[model samples]
Target: MNHLDHGTEVNPIKSNTKSIITDHNKDDHNAQEVKAIVRGPIPAAAVPDHMWQAVIANDRAYDGQFFYGVTSTRIFCRPSCKSRPPKKEHVFIFQHAEQALQAEFRPCKRCKPTGVRLPEQEWIDIVKTYIDDHYASPVTLNTLADISHSSPYHLQRTFKRLMGISPNAYVQEVRIQHAKERLRGTKESIADIGAKVGMDNVSYFVTLFKQKTGMTPSAYRENKASNTMNDVCTPD
Candidate 1:
């Protein structure tokens, strides 16, 4: 008994003609003709159900197999991206990293889906630079992510993890510090000083100032004024 390891077994054909179709016949040669098949990696459309579930679970095993992007946010990530999972309906699957890039989706900073890696501290430093430059303007998580090339979710997570403060809190601290400078150096009205430091609402500014420094903006200004006077009155 002989057993073949590969290739398909061909069936014998019984024809009405006088010739018999056997392994030695031309018909057997036609049956043995093999068609070459070239197969590439499976596309997203053909991804298995288990693979999709792995993405939801953030299983690292599927990291290189596929990528997913949130259509609403336009950000792509590896299967094991640490960021919170987007709604399934908004997720668009990619066969590979390049496919996500071709769709104009930014790679997630946390996952390094696009292979462009920036250190965690470097990202935090970029965010700090943005905060320092835009402290006087409106600052939001989205704005920080836009300037730092990261997702708002990732930015907030990394900023909190590394800096021990939320982005919004950091911005408020910067604004309050700027307000302090304006209050001490200039004789401007408290409201104007609040406005100068990006706090348009004077009441809110006063409340924040008191919460942070235990003194109202007016009290801080008066205290500075008194200290200046004492400096002039006292002997050098």
Candidate 2:
């Protein structure tokens, strides 16, 4: 397997603080929604000069959905900040934190543009909100980080450090746990349970259920039924 296949952000160019900036801004998602949803490393793209000026202006009239990647530091932001403007040569507009990281631009400790600095408690709480809202849909840490103006690496690190597991893992655990509950509490088929949990690979779902609970999903259902029956027969 290509070592690069693993989950870290992918940077095509070695870190080039000066040269990463370029002209031309076109992304498919810009027209689709008020907010962007990203799930992987930021793609390399061209950015125009006027866009930077628009950001410094914080022209809410100008769509900010794709403009805040630099809001946490020197690269992005309104032209209106009290501090002096960034050198034209050193500035580049990133659409997301993964883009900045791929370009090797460290977050401004002062601005900390990404929502990554949120306390673990707050981070988990927000993640729960995301899950509640989008659990049935296809979503990933990259998507969640996109909501926070940061990269998957930043969010994953903070989430793991605080929650003791990767965000993706926590999501999977939550999904599987929910699936198990439905399987035991309802007459839903194994396939329905899997689908309800955002899983479609019936075989893989069964395997995961077995791995996590030491029993097939069907067996788990049977166990739950038997327990209910025994409880009903016994007092209270």
Alpha-carbon lDDT, every model: 0.75, 0.60
Candidate 2 lDDT tens digits, 22-47 = 31123323333223332332222434
Candidate 1 lDDT, tens digit per residue, 1-59?
99767886544453423355443466344323211110223334554566567677888
Predict model 1's lDDT versus the native: 0.75
* Model 1 segments more than 4 A misplaced: 1-114
Error of 2 at 91 (Å): 27
* Model 2 TM-score, 2 decimals: 0.52
Q: What does the lDDT read for residue 96 in candidate 1?
A: 72
The TM-score that candidate 1 achieves is 0.53
The estimated TM-scores of all candidates read: 0.53, 0.52
Model 2 / residue 207 / CA error / Å: 1.1
